[model samples]
Target: METMIGLPFTPKVLIVDDKPYDVKILEMKLREVGCQVAIATDGLSAIEETRKFKPHLVLLDIRLPDIDGYEVCKRLKNDADLKEIPVLFISAYGDVTDKVRGFESGAVDYISKPYEFEEIFARVKTHLMLRSLQIQLEEQNKRLEMLVEEKTKELVEVNKKLAMLDATKNELLQLVANDLRTPLTGLFSVLDSLIYEELKDQLTKDQLKAYDKAKQQMLSTLEDALLLTQIDVSNTDRVYGEIPIQQVIKQALNNVRPIATSKSVSIVECEAKDFKIFGDQNLLTRAFTALFEIAIRFSARHERIQLQLGTFDHHIELSVYVIGYTIPPDYIGTFFDLSSSARLNILGGELGIKPAIVHRIIALNGGSISVKNEGPAGVLFIIKFPFI
Candidate 1:
């Protein structure tokens, strides 16, 4: 065969045979076909010549003056640096066993004693061409792997920048929500005073109800905004302590009494055992307040709002229920999601933080929350907490 494309560098051949005549014939033929040839009379010298010459191919005879061709081929293939140099066995022993042994010894193929130069040239050309393609493929794979690693690093940096931007936006939102709190507080104070003063006689029952509802909704918005700031923890890291659920409930009820009175909705603390859990008391108090506020706003006029606290499966179970409104079953699925609150038409006394902030506070305390609608009868908000 004529010269063909197989390697980036000039091909070199190492002929391992003790017969001077055999070595001379192969050396002349390989050189004529544009291959640089190196000679080794024994297996020991063949390995040495391969190292020095770094030939692209090796032409080995089965019988060497010292080590056999099988051992030489095995040694060449075992070496990480030399294994890619294709070894072709050339021997006078042309039995099936000899051919099998040659291949088992890592020879690419075996050639008979009275070898045809055309067969030699064809096998060498094919193996060398295959070897060159394997090397190119490995190089391409390494480059692809490196490219994937670089892209992964770039994605990590982008995520870090996005997180920083989110933190900045939350900070700005906290500032705005804080500024709105004071005026809403003042609005409630004035309304409460008016309904109790001499002007109380001048205001009709419906007008007083309107003022109360307005005050309650405004306060709900204020609390939501306030809770938004607390959600991220400001001085919250080291202030945890034991909090009695009863004490928290008492505070929430006291804060909610006026709203309940205005709506003519009655509230009662049902049968519950006293228990304590570890958490941030002030935050938990605000969380309970949000729960009560939601209950009061949702309860029908003159309806009963029942709150119960008990233990269940090593957990503190707190449930609030209103006698008539049935929360849609599908709404229960998104009950704790913040988007649900955000989508509410808040003017109808619906708060924009009910399950969102309420669930977050309980979750941060290592607890979980769930909701259920007892159709045609009532809706329940159940909050469970683990003892710290």
Candidate 2:
């Protein structure tokens, strides 16, 4: 006897027939091939055995002693638990009408009487294989559903944690900004009053220069902190419109001109045909001002910085070349990350947070900024904005 392999388990078959010799032959052949066989001489007995055996396939004869095979198939198919089991009809009535009725009664296949035992075995094997595959598919689908449910729950928990962290961070930023800005504002008022000619005469040239530099650095740091907090908290209320790129650049230049002059770093602006981009004009100008200030601060005295603008296929490009300084290669990767220790160390004091602010502002306006070493001794900052 050849053992049936490759199935998840031994195939169980239910045979329903009135003939004793026919039933015995089929039962012997099924058992020889490692099938567990159950016999029924009537339709009701077949139904009973099917429920008890939970067989993989059913071989039913049309003429049953108690109830017809068609009625048995119908009853089995009506039961939710038994419906998936395939029923193959084996009957002496080998007519087209009988086969049609068998199919209508939910039989999977129909075979006429006087059929070869080999043909019967072949049909049984095919249906058993199909049942095995269906069981495997059902098992796999159940596993996948379970996995998806588990992952979805994990994602929900992660999102909740992230939301809590974000809220805490915003609250902290607001507190820090309020505490620092109040003192800085009062100091600026005192400094403005001290700028009067009568009061100014009290300080020497070196004293005045140091006082001015200190004031500028403090003011810059305060402004950057306040702006960063505003950007984080009020993103939804930003005013946006189409603004000319040249006008924005000009405004930024004017804003940074005093510092640039103080550092003796001249900026050369290259003219291009004006292009308009959609963004918050004030924010864009502030971003550009921050970039120019960073370039100016890092450049040597009298080093000329070049500003150029051009249009690409989908976006407008602005490039600033700081002629005297190049960022070290390692720091370039995390230059715009506010939390990066390297960036904090390199751009110390008031300038430390400006790049991160610039990056956020550009991102909010659907723009991007990047910095890289250019030529032998210069750093280049490239900014791209969507063309309107």
lDDT (CA) per prediction: 0.81, 0.87
- Residue 42, model 1: lDDT of 97
Question: Given candidate 1, what's the lDDT at residue 137?
Answer: 86
Worst 10-residue lDDT window for candidate 1 reads: 341-350
TM-scores for every predicted model: 0.62, 0.70
Highest TM-score: give the candidate number. 2
| Tens-digit lDDT track of model 2 for 262-292 | 8888999979566998899989899989988
Scored against the true structure, residue 272 in model 2 reaches a CA lDDT of: 56
